[model samples]
Target chain A: MTENGFDTSCGASSGTRILVIEDEDTITEFLKTGLKYEGYQVTIAKDGVTGVDCAREMEPDLIILDIMLPDKDGFEVCRRIRRRDSDVPILMLTAKKEISDKVKGLDVGADDYLTKPFSFEELLARIRALLRRSGRAVDSTELRVVDIVLNTETREVYKGGKKVSLTPTEFSLLELFMRHPRRVFTRETLLNRIWGYDYAGDTNIVDVHISHLRDKIGDKPPCLIRTHYGVGYAFYPGEGK
Target chain B: MWKKLSLRTRLTILYAGLLALLLTILGVTFFIDTRNLLIENTASHIRATAKPIIEHWLYGENLSSQAIEGTKKKPDSKYLKKISRQLARDLTSRNVVAIVLDKNGKVIANGKVLEEEPAPVSPNPFYYRRAFSGENEVTYILSTDNKNVLVLLIPLRSAPGSDHVLGVVQLSSPLTPVERILYRHGLTLAVGTLITLILGTALGLLLISSALSELRHMIATCQSITEGRMDQRVHLPQRSDEVGQLAQAFNRMVERLEASFSAQRRFVASAAHELRTPLTALRGSLEVLMRGAQDDPATVAHLCHGMYREVLRLSKLCEELLDLAKLEISENVQKEKVVLKEFVNEFEEQARVLSQEREISILEGPSVSLKADPNMLKQILFDLLQNALQHTGRNGRIALGWKLGDNGVDIWVEDNGHGILAEDLPHIFEPFYQGKKVSECGEHHKGSGLGLTLVKAMVEAHGGSIEVRSEVNRGTTFLIKLPFE
Candidate 1:
C-alpha cells in the first residue's frame, strides 16, 4: 500500500485521460496536480462553455464535473458530452449535498457523484467505480485481499485454497469489499449497491450476513472484514497480522 | 394618529355630533315659524273684533248724545256707561275688553277688564295721535300678569263723515290661546329632539359595534401571533364591503408574517444542522489522528485529507450563507429587454467551459424576446443548467432551449440523466433540504442547500415561475417561465 492507502500495484491506465470542469482556479490547479500525481493525463476547463468544447475535442476517458460554473453548469456539460460520446464515465462534484442535486447530476448522464471537501481516496474510488461500471477500467475480473480471493467471472470464492460457498447477495457484498479493500463502506451503501436501488429490506440483513460469512471463513486465524465501530465495515488485507 | 381611538368609539361620537347639529337646526326653524304665526293671528283677531263694535257705538242713536258731549272732551261716566253697556251687548266676544276714552285721553268707560291692572286709559301719545287722525292702530302689550295682550285704538267720528273727532274706542284682547299653542308646540319639539337624539345614539353605537367586529378579530389574531401562535387566522365575514376588505387585508398580512417567522426558524435550524455535519466530520478525523493513526503515514494522509475536506465544506457553507443574505436583500432586479437568440448565443460562449468533459448542447427554439433583469435572468439559467449538469453523467445529453408563448418565454434545461426520486420533488427548492439521493450516491458533503432556494426566489422576484418534470432513470427538465411584462 502506498502512503495514500492505495494499492500502487493496480495502477491506472498509462494513458488514462481525465477532464476537469471547474470555475475556481485554485481547485482546478489542485485537481490537475493531484490527478496527474496519480498517473492520469489531466485537462482543465475554466468555465462551462469551454469545458463542453474540450470534451468534444479531447474525448477524454473520464470527466469530473463541478456543479457550479461561471457560464454553463456541470450538468449541461455532462449532457453535451453525452450527446457526442456515449461511453465515457462522468463523476459529478458539487459543494452542495442536496439529494436533488445528486439526482439531477445522475439524471444528466453522470455515472457517479462526489461532493466537495472529498478525500482523494474517495474521489479515486468513485472514479474507479464509474470506470469499472462503464467497462473501461483495467481492473481485473478476480478480486483478492490476503488469502480470500473472489472470481467475478465464475462467481467463485476461495479461502486459503479452500472453496467457500456464498449466496448471490453475499458474493456481491464480498466482491465490493474486496475491490475497495481497506475502504470503509456504510451499511446503507452496501444495501444500495448489493440489494439494488429499491431495496427496502432491513439494514441488519447486512450485519446478519456479515457475521455468518465471518463465522464460515474462520475468524480465528485472520480477521478479513473489520468493523469500523459505529461507522461501517472495511475489508482489511491483514498485512499487519 | 387617530388609530389610538377604538373604531366603535370614534364612529359613535361622529354620528352623535352630526345628529345633534341636525336636530338643533330643525328645532330653531320650527320655533321661529310657530312664534311668527301665533303673533300675526292674534293681531288680526283683535282688529276684526274692534271694527264692528266701533261702528255700532258711533252710529247708534244712544251714543250720539254721548258723542256730542264728548265733543266737549269732558268725562261723562253715566252716559259712557250706558254706551259701553250697549256696545258690550252688541258684541259678545270672549277675552276682549272695551274701554271708552275722552278726546283728552281720560277713561270714560271700563268694561270687562280681564286683569286687575285696568287697561291703561292714558294711551301712548304716539298711538293717540294715530287714533286722532282717524287711523286705527294695534299694539302688543306684555302685561304684568304674563299675558300677551293685543290693543286696537280707533277714533270716534260724529256720523262717519264728521270732521270733529269724538272720543276714541280702545279694544284689548288677552293672547292666552296663542301662547298656549306655542307652549304646546315648544314642549313637543323639545321632547321629540330628546327622543331622536337618544335613538340616534343607540343605533349609531349598534352599527359601530357591528362594523368594528372585524377590527376586534384582527386585534385578537395579532395578539395570538405575538404570543407565538403563528397559525392563528381571523375568520372573516363573507361581505365585500370596506370592513370585509380590511379583514381580508389584515388576514393576508398576518399570514405573510407567520410564514416569514416560520421560514426564519427553519433557516436557523437547517443552517445549524448543515454546519454541524461538517464540524462533526472534522472532529472525528482529528480524534482518529490523535489516537495514534498519525504513526502510519497512509492513515495520517487519509485523516488529514478528510479533515481538510470538512474545513472546506465549512468555509463554503459560510460563503453560501452570505450569498443567501445578499440575494434576499437585493430588492430590485436590473431589467432589460433580453433577446433570446442573442442571449443564448452569449451564454453558449460562456457555458462551453462548464461542460469540459460532458456533452452539452444548446437548441435554438424561437427568437423570443423578454423584458427581465439581465443578471437575475442569467442566474436563473445558470442555476437550472448547473442543476442538470450535476445529475447527468458522461454520454448523457442536456439540452437548453426556449419556447415563445403568448404569456411569456419558456426557457428549459433538459437532461437525460438520473432523475430525482418522487419523494424529493416537492422539497427540492426548500433551503437546506438534503435529499436521500445524496446519501444514496454516498456523497459525504453537501452545499449550503440554498442553490435551488435562491433560484426560486430570484425567478419569483422577476415575476416568473419554475417547474420540474422528472422520471426515475429517464431524465429531468427544469422549465422556467419568465413573463415579458
Candidate 2:
C-alpha cells in the first residue's frame, strides 16, 4: 500500500488505463498527474468532440469525463463511448452541484458522477470503485484489508480466519467498504449503494446495520470499520506495517 | 373664494341662484301686470263718471232752456253752481276729483264743489283746448305731491255721431291705492321667492352631499393605500353611475398593486433563503479548515473542495437572480418567425451530445412556423431537455420534437424517466422550490432551483404556454404550445 492508496499486492499492479475528457487545463493536468502517480496509464482530451474520438481510439479501461466541453459536453462523450464499449466504466465530473447533473450523467451511461472542485482522494476512490464494479481493477472476486476478508462471488465474510455470517444489506455494506478501504462513505452514500437509489427510509438504519455487522464480525480493540465523527465511516486497517 | 368652495357647496349655490332668478322674473311680471290693471280700472271709473255729467250738460236732459243755454255757453257763475251740484253725485269714489270746462276755455263746474267755500277754481286752460279736438283724452301724471294721478278729458257733442265740438269735461284721480295694492303683492312675491330659495338651497346641499359621498369614500381608500394597506377598497354602490365605476376601477387597481407587492416580497424572501444555504456551506467549510484541518493534506483538500463548490453555488444563484430580474423587467417581446424544423435541428447536436449513452433523438414534425422570441424560446427548450435528461436512465428513450396542432404548434421533450410526484407538479415552477424528494436527498439535486421557473417565465414571455403530464416510473412529457403569429 502506497500513499496514493495503491495496493501493490493486488494482482494487477500497473497499466490500468484511464481516459480523461476535460476542457479545463488545470483539471486535466491534476487528473493526469494524480492518476499517473497512482500507477495507472492516463490519456487526456481537451474537448467533447475530441474526447469521443479519443475514447474510441484509446479504449481505456476507465474514463473520467467533464460534463461541460467546448464542441460537445461530457454526456455526449459518455454516450458515444458507451455505444461501442458498454462494459467500460465512465465517471462524470460536472461543475454543477446538481443531482440532476449526476442523474443525467448516469442516465447517459456514466457509472457515477463527481461534482467539480472534488478532492483528489475522493476522485480516486470513485474511479477505483467504478473500475472495480466493471471488474477491470480488482481481478479477484475477493477483497481483503488486514485480517478482514470479503468474497464477492461467495458473498462470504471472514474475520481473523473465522467465518462470519452477514445479512444481505450488511454484506453489501461491508463489501462496498472493503472494495475501497480507507475511503470515507457517508451514511447517505452507503444507503444509496446498499439499499437502492430510491430508498426513502431513515438514515439510522445504516448505523444500526453497521453496528450489527461490527458485532457479528467480532472487531478487536482497533475496530476494522472506523467511525469518523462529524463525517462518516471508513474501513481503516491498522497503522502497523 | 368661490373657487375654493367644495363641489357640493358650489352645486348647491348654483341651484339656489337659478331658482331665485326664475322667481324674480315671475314676480316682476305679475306685479307690473296687476298694477297696470288696477291703474286702468281707476282711470276708466273716473272717465265713466265724467261721460254722464258731460252728456247731461250738453243735452240739457232735465234743464229749462235758460239753464241749458247758460250751461252750453261757458256756464256763468250762477249756472256753473247748478252744473257742479249735478256732477257732485259721481265724485264719491276714492281719490276722485272732477272738473268741467266750457268751449270758451272758462271753468264752469267742479265735482268737489260742495267742499269749496269760493267756487272751486276752474281746471287748467290747456285741458279745455286739448279736449276740444272732437275726441276724448286720458293721461296719467305724477302730481307735485308725489301722488300718481289719472286724468280723463271728454269733448261732448249735442247729439250722437256728431263731430261738432262742445264744452269739455275733465276728471282726475290719485293712483296711491293701486300703488299700495301692487306694493303689497310684490312684497309677498319677494318673500315667497326668498323662502323658495332657502328650501332649494337646502335640497341642493342634500343632493350634492349624497352624490359626492362615493368620491369621499374613494379618497379614504386612497389614504388607506398610501398608509401601506394596499388591500383596502372603496365601498361600492349598486348603481353603475360614474362614481360607482370609478370605485370598481380603483379596487381593481389596488388588487393588482397588492399582488405585485406580494410577489416582490416573496421573491426577496426566497432569494434570501437560497443564499443562506450556500453561505452556510461556505462558513462550515471555512470553520473546519480553520480548526486545524489545514494541517492534514487530505482534509485540507476536501474542505477547500467543498468551499469551492459552495462558491460556485453562490455564483450560480447570482446568475439566476439576475435572470429573474431581467425577466421581470422585460416588458416587450421581440418576435421572429422560427421554423420548427430549424429549431429542432439545433437540438440534434445537443441531443447527440447529451444522449451519448442514452437513446435520444429528435422527431421533427411538419414544417410548422410560429412567431416567438427566439432567445427565450431556446432557453425554454433547453430547460425542459435538461430536466428530461436528469430523470431518464441509461438506454432510456428520450424524444425532442414538435407537432402541428389545431391552433398552433406544440413542441415537446419527453422521456421514459422517473416522473415528478403529483404534489410537486404545481410548485415545480416556483423559484427556490425543488421537488420534495430532491430536497431530502443526501446530495441535493444540484440546481439553482430556478430552472423550471425560468422556463415558465421564458415560455410566457414568448406568448406561449407550457403543460406537463407524467406517470410515476413510466415517463414525463413537457409540451409548449405557441400560437401562430
Candidate 3:
C-alpha cells in the first residue's frame, strides 16, 4: 500500500486476527512485528498450555504454531485446540525436515506447515490465502455504505453515483472501513492496515491517508473518518456529508 | 588346506573319521577271532570222531594179526587195505573226509570219498613217514580237488600203547564248510563294519551340525545387525556346552553394540536439533534485516542484538558438542585425590557468586576421599548450581552435601523451590530438552539446555552415576554416587 506495491485488503485483511504459538522469543517477536506490518491482528503465547487457552479465547481466523514448546509440544496443543474448534486454520512451524514430523503435524489437524527461517513475505501470503480460503474475511465483490460504493475487485470507488479516483492505499483504506461500517479503526490500525505498520514513528501518516480519502470521496467539514483524539481513527457512515 | 575349511566342516570330518577307524578295527578283530574259533571247533570234532574209529581199527588190526602171521605185520598192502577200508568208513562224515594211507604213504582206502566227495590226493611220503615214527601230525593242504584240507595223520599201532609196524590213519576234513562259514562270516563282518561306519558317520554329522547350529544362528544375527537391525539376537535355548557359552558372549556383545549405536544416534539427533534452533534464529534475523528492516534504526538494533545472542548460543553449542564427542572418544579421566569437605567449601564460594540474592548452603556430611578430576567436578557442581539458581526464588534454600552410602559416596543437591512436573522429570537430563519453568524470577536466567546433559556425561565418565527425584510444587534433588577407589 502507498506505493509499497502491497495491498493489505485482499477481500478484507484489516483486523484479521491471527494467533502465534511459539517458544522461541526472537522468532515470536519477529513474527509479531512482521505479521502486524502486513496488517493482521497477532496474538502470541509462549508455551503450549497458554497457547491452547489463547486459541480458545482468541477464536482466531488462523493459528501459527511451533512444535517445540517449553511445557508441552505443539502437537499436543494442536490436538487440544482442534478438539474445541475444528474450523480454525492452523499453520505449524517445524525445525526438522523429517517427513514424519510434517506428516504427524498434519495428522494432528494442522492445516499446513512451514520450516523455520521462513521469509515474512511467504508467511503473509500464506496467512492471506488461509484467511480467504477459510471464508473468514469479507469476500463480497462490492460494498455499499451510505451511498459510498467501493468495488473491491476493480479497485474503484463511487460516491452518490459519481465515480471518484483514489490511490491504491486510499482505496484499500476505504475498503477496510466499508467492510465493517461504523467500527472504530484506530490510527495504529489504519497505519497497520494501510501503510504496512513497519515504523512506530509518528502516526500522522494515517491522518494524511484519511484526509486524502475524505477529499477524494467529496467529504469535508469533520466527516467520513471521526477522530478519537489521543487514540485512533474510525469510519462514520451517516455523519459524513 | 585343513585350516582353510570351516570349523564345522573340520570337526565333522574329524569325528566321523575317528569313529570309522574305531569300528573297522573292532570288526576286524572280532572276525579274525571267530574264524579261528570255528576252525578249532572243526579240528576238535574230527579228533573226537577219529577217537572211536582208531579204537575199532586197532581191534580189527589185532584180529587180522592174530589170524594172519600172528602180529608180524610188515609191508602188507593187502592185510592193511582191509583194515584201512574199515577205518575210513567209520571216520568219514559231513565236512570230514577220512583217508587211510599205508606206512609207505599210499592211500589204501578212501571210504567212497574218491567217488562222491573227491578225496584228497595221496599223502606226502615224508609227512606220513614221520607219522610212522609214532607222531600224530596235523597240517593244512590245498588238495587236488581245489578244496582246503585239514589233515591229521595218525600212525596205526598193533595194540594200545604198542610199538608195532602198522599203517597211517589220515583223518582229513574238507575245509569247504569251515571255508564257507568263514567266507559268510567275513562278509558279515565287512557289511556290518560298513553299516556301522556309515551310521556312525551320519550320527556324528548330525550331532556336529546340531552343535554348530547355534553358531550359524549367531552368524545370521550378525549379518542382520550389519544390515542395521541392531536388535537382532541369537536367542538360543540354554545349553551348557561351548556353543552356549559363545552365544551368551555374542549376545552380550550385541547388546553393548546396540546400546552404543543408539546412544550415538541420539547424540547426532540432539546435536542437529540443537544447532538448528540457533541457526534458524540467526538466519531469520539476518533475513529480516536484509529485507528493509535495516531502514529502521530501532528494528536494525534489535535484530543485530538478536543475531549476536544467537551467534553466542551457536558457539556455546559447539563447545558443548566438542565436550560430548571427547567424552565418547576417551572415557579416560584424570583422577586425582580430592577431599569432599574442602572441595565443597571452595565450590560453595564460587556458586554464591552466580546469584547474590539466593540462599545456598551446605549440609554437614561424611568427610570422604575420592579419586576424581577436581576441575570436572567443579564444572559439574557449577552447572547444577546454575540450574538450581534458575529454579529457585530469592529466598528459596538449596542444600548441597555428601553422604556415605553402602558402597559409594552420594553427593546431593536439593532445592526447596517449585519441583518438576512428572512428565518433564524424565526428560530433564536429555540434551536440548527444556523443562517447565518453575521460578518466577528466573525468567532472565538463560541456559544453553545442554547443562544437565554435560553434567551427566562428566559424572558417568568418572565411573559414577547421577539420579534425580522430584515432586511437583514441593522440591527436587539430584544425587551423584562416586564409588571409592
lDDT (CA) for every model shown? 0.73, 0.71, 0.77
Which of candidates 1 and 2 is the stronger one according to TM-score? 1
Best-matching candidate per TM-score: 3
Q: Measured with DockQ on alpha carbons, how good is candidate 1?
A: 0.02
Off by over 4 Å in 3: A1-14, A83-86, A135-241, B1-24, B48-94, B98-118, B121-146, B153-169, B183-224, B231-252, B355-368, B403-408, B417-428, B434-446
Give the per-residue lDDT of model 3 (tens digit) for B148-263: 77777777776667677588877776777888988898898888888888888788888888988877888899899899999998887888788989989888999998887887
The predicted structure with the larger TM-score, 2 or 3, is: 3
A93-147: candidate 3 lDDT, tens digit per residue: 9878789999999999998888865666577667767776788875456676666
Q: What TM-score does candidate 3 reach?
A: 0.71
lDDT of 2 by residue, B296-352 (tens): 577557656766877788898999899888888974578888887887788577767
lDDT of 1 by residue, A168-234 (tens): 8788777766655666777866765677546798989989988887876675534668887887788
DockQ-based ranking:
3, 1, 2
| lDDT minimum window of 10 residues, candidate 1 chain B | B438-447
Ranking by TM-score: 3, 1, 2
TM-score of candidate 2's chain B against its reference? 0.68
Q: What is the lDDT of residue B474 in candidate 2?
A: 83
TM-score of each: 0.55, 0.51, 0.71
Model 3: what TM-score for its first chain? 0.60
